[model samples]
Target: MTRYKIGVVGCGFFGSSLARELAAHPRFELAMLCDRDFERAKDVAAEFSATPTDDHDAVAADPELALVVVATPNHAHAEPAIAALEHGKAVFVEKPLAVELVDAQNMIASADASGSPLMVGHIMRMMPGVRRLADLLASGELGEVAAIETSRSRWIDTDGADPQWWKLDKSRTGGELTHEIHELDLMCWLGGEVTAVSSIATADDGFRNTVVSFAGGAIGRHTISTRSHTSSWELTVDAAEGSVHADFHTGRVSRLRGGRVEESWPIFDVDAENQSLIDSASRTQKYNSGNGGSSLWMQAAIRHEIDEMAAVLDGKADSGSPLTYARERALVVAEQVRLGGGEPAALSGSAK
Candidate 1:
């Protein structure tokens, strides 16, 4: 097996977790861990026997690095990713592509100019349950997808949150729309390209919703609420024949017809699925809390995504360009601005 040398920028929760997983992968050699917080980088690097550096530029410039994984904060993704891509390294960007459309486009353009393999980290697509759901849709068992409704809602207490908490900043996280973009991306992947985004609404309590129309004639409603008393992460596809639902909180996917479950399966292996169910029963949030890592199935999904990137770098066919995901995301962002009383024309450089 040809091993790839990997450098990860942002040694925070997601970056550290990904670095740990990559260290365990047979086809990956953890080469570098970079973060502005040098101590954090050193801690993660020590675990993997990898070099630690605070300089992101050093990772991109390192001749020994073969792949650069940008797991930085939502808005900070572009610079490191583009730098790595320009240096001719295969780059994997943790999703939303970028907080801003221009940055996202620039990242893609850099990859194109450098002939580097660029992939977005949309781990939801690799989830076993989601994969099965995709398979069912593709096989025509679920029929043509007519609509997709997704929600990831949890209470985010900002009363005493640290001022440095990046997620609290709409500019950095792009609110829930880009921050919790897994649902939107999954909706587009299953329902097809976004043709129109009809409405986008937000509330003072951190509730956001967007109504989108797909080119394939499917309608989608994506929602995210940090004000909810109940926490949930789920997506349901209503198709011509039946419906399929994936409950991330429980790590289960079900196929239904005539208002009954026709088939059901774990989103991951049995142990992981059971763990998710147990965790969900006691959890207050659907996503990672503080510096904690993601759930078991989510970690597994990341591993699958790494393998996909490896395959793509090995000259195999890619699932799709990261640009496609970024473009779809930009459409939703544009709509949000238009509906929020901001000029749609601002989208050209709005996020910049």
Candidate 2:
């Protein structure tokens, strides 16, 4: 068995976590850690026994590295990812792809030009529970998807985040909608391509509600908030045959007809999932600060995506293309940011 050599740019919370996972996996060798902050890179590199550097260009130019994981701040994603892609290195960028439309387009274009695989990290879609729901919809077990909705809301513990925290900068994070794009991307993936969307958002854009029209004639409602006292992450789908719901808060997905559940599946392992939630609540009832200590369920999702990336490298599975699902999600977010407080707007491209 040959291990693909990989390196991670941006040695922050998510990037370091990814490095740790890749190091532990047998199919990949974590070779380098890069960050603008040398100390951050050094610390993470020490843990993983990988070289540490502050130069992304060096990482991109290294011939030995087959993959470059871009876990930089949302606004900074394009530069490193585009560099790696242009160098013919497989690149995996964390979600939201990019905060702006132009940057996203540039990243996609570079990937196409270089013929290197580019994958965005949308871990929600990789979860076993979400996969089960997607399978049901694809098989028409729930009939045609008439409507799909997702709600993700939780309070942050800060009035305003630390000045150094990029998430507090709307220009960088694209507010809550783009920052919490997992649900937005999930709706499009599980439902279908969006034709148009109408949204309402708060002044600060910390809360947003959007209605999406799908090319398949299905509709979707997405609601996200960062100001809720109670925290929940759930999705519900309505179809001609019946309805289904998934509650990540409780790690359960159920199929229903006539208001009764016909089948139920654990989102992950039931005991571990429940324990993770308990531990999470005991630590902080508020939203995760991305300072580490993510739930076991989330860790599992990351591992699953890592496996997918490896499979793509081994030619066993197709790369998770940014041109399709990721672009679709980014388009919806762009429209949400544009027409968020105005009249309904059609998606920029032709309907699916």
Candidate 3:
């Protein structure tokens, strides 16, 4: 098997985690780590046995780097991704694709022209529960999903903090576009393309909450804030036969049918024999399985995506097309923010 050299741009939590994981994967070598903060990038690079640099162009220019992961702040996603693709590297980008639709379209076009695969880290779509739900929906077990509701909220201590942060800025992080777009993507993936959306948003103390309606008559409500103490997400789908609820935070699933209810505990031991369609269709690849304390759910999703990308690279699998759909869903969320009538704020501070 050919080992791929991977470069990571951004030394934040997500980027650092991915770097460490890639370093451990036997199929990938962490070739470089980049960050605006030289010290932070150097620290992460040291941990992964990779060179640390403040210059993204150096990483993109590296002949050994076959893949690049852009984990930078929301506003910083486009340039590095485009640069890496232009330099002939496959790319994995954290969500929202880009802050603006135009940037997102450009990124997509670059990947198309470069003939290099581009994947968006809408990680929730890789979740076991989500995959199971998709399977159920496809099998018609739910019998026509009538409506879907999802919420993601977390409170971060930002007292006396800068109010013009990327996460709060409508122009950069795009508020819900960074955080809750996963839910939007999941809703659309399980439901259908959202033809239209109407939303209401509130911005105060650097937080926003919005509710939206999708095309297939499915409604979605979202709350994203840096002011909550706990991170919680739940998705409920109402169907003709009954309803299914999944507490994404806990990885628990509940079902109601004919007034009888049952709850399923987390399936920690993924059934090795029963491979999902996504799994079976994915390319085979070995990943550095790191320190092993990371969340199993997260590991599974990352592995699935890595495998899918490997397949695409190997010409044994189709390019992961869901990213385009995820992008469309993000557009709807962006429109929701636009129609919601929130106060305009300049982009400042890091998106993290």
**Best-first order by lDDT:** 2, 1, 3
Q: Candidate 2 lDDT, tens digit per residue, 44-80?
A: 9999889999999999999999999999999999999
The sequence of per-residue lDDT tens digits that candidate 3 reaches over residues 1-352 is 8788889999886787677667777778888999999999988888877899999999889998898999887778999999999998888888767767667777877887898877788877766666666667668876877787776565544454456544445556665445457766666566655554545445453455555555556655555554555565677788888888777544466777876675453423374312432242232221222123444445666776666555655656543344333454555456546655332222111110
TM-score of each: 0.87, 0.90, 0.77
Each candidate structure's count of clashing pairs? 0, 0, 7
For all candidates in order, the CA lDDT equals: 0.75, 0.77, 0.66
Pick the TM-score winner. Answer: 2
Which of 1 and 2 is the better model by TM-score?
Answer: 2
Model 3 bad stretches (over 4 Å):
160-171, 203-217, 223-232, 262-308, 315-325, 339-352
lDDT of 2 at 340: 45
Q: Between the candidate structures 2 and 3, which one is better when assessed by TM-score?
A: 2
- Model 3 lDDT at residue 267: 27
> Model 3: number of clashes?
7
Q: What TM-score should be assigned to candidate 3?
A: 0.77
- Give the alpha carbon lDDT tens digit for every residue of 213-287 in model 1: 766788888787777888778899999899999887776788898889998888776685557654753466533
| TM-score, ranked from best to worst | 2, 1, 3
Ranking 1 against 2 by lDDT, winner:
2
